[model samples]
Target: MLKYKLVSRANPRKRNEKQFYAQLTGVQTIKRCDFLSLLEKRSSMSSADVKSFLDALEFELMHRLANGISIRLGDLGSFRATIRSVGAVNKKDYDQRKYIKGVNVRFRPSAKWMREKSKTGELISFETVGKA
Candidate 1:
């Protein structure tokens, strides 16, 4: 049986406006160690111990990513730099649109994850679908 739940926050704009919003919900597991139990033998450790270790590891990762360094987790993924816009753009200067100040963050994922995903199915052409 799956012990953990997948949780997420709703997009504020979608609330109470659509039927799908009711269906869309986030279910996060109680803690990371709860997930760790699935991959390894954890009979010796308590949940609190596992949680503390995982939390420390996550903090270290965020620290490294903030310094423009990528953290590679085996069989998971790699975290790399990404840019985001900060300030508002002036409508008159179209040429300046490409230049925007932003921050850096790391992304993590490994090839094994991709391989597992590929076995699910092949992509279908959008045109093949009939209109409702």
Candidate 2:
């Protein structure tokens, strides 16, 4: 279950009006070690082995992304790297060195994953806990 509280704040861009939204009462964080322990029981590999495997996977993912490649993760999703650049006046003036502004990574989930997540029969609930 997800618990949240309604929060009211003055609209910075608008005058004499307040904006309301639901904010999470608390957040739970899961760490690498905790995840490794859970994975260890589900796999034949030990925690240390799982940790090493995850490290290698992350390294390879970053390496491939840096080389302008997209990697597919079967049913989970795929990761892609993209860059945004400033506009140039002409084709002759368009140079990556001067026009490139930022680089970012994007993930797209698979259709199966999205379909399963959209099913209302799944055991998921949201609770409102008043104001924050």
lDDT per residue (tens digit) for residues 19-130 in model 2: 9887887668899889889999999998889999999999999999999999999988999999999899899988899999989999998887677753563544578997
TM-scores for every predicted model: 0.46, 0.71
TM-score of 1: 0.46
Q: Candidate 1, which ten residues in sequence have the lowest lDDT sum?
A: 123-132
Regions more than 4 Å wrong, model 2: 1-28, 121-125, 128-132
Compared with the true structure, the alpha-carbon lDDT of candidate 1 equals 0.57
- lDDT score of residue 34 within candidate 2: 92
Candidate 1 per-residue lDDT, tens place, 1-132, comes to 212323344557886443221122233556455586642364566666666777788898878877778888887789876767655467566443565566666564577766664444332111212221
Candidate 2: global Cα-lDDT? Answer: 0.87
Q: In model 1, where do residues sit more than 4 Å from their true spots?
A: 1-43, 85-101, 104-108, 117-132
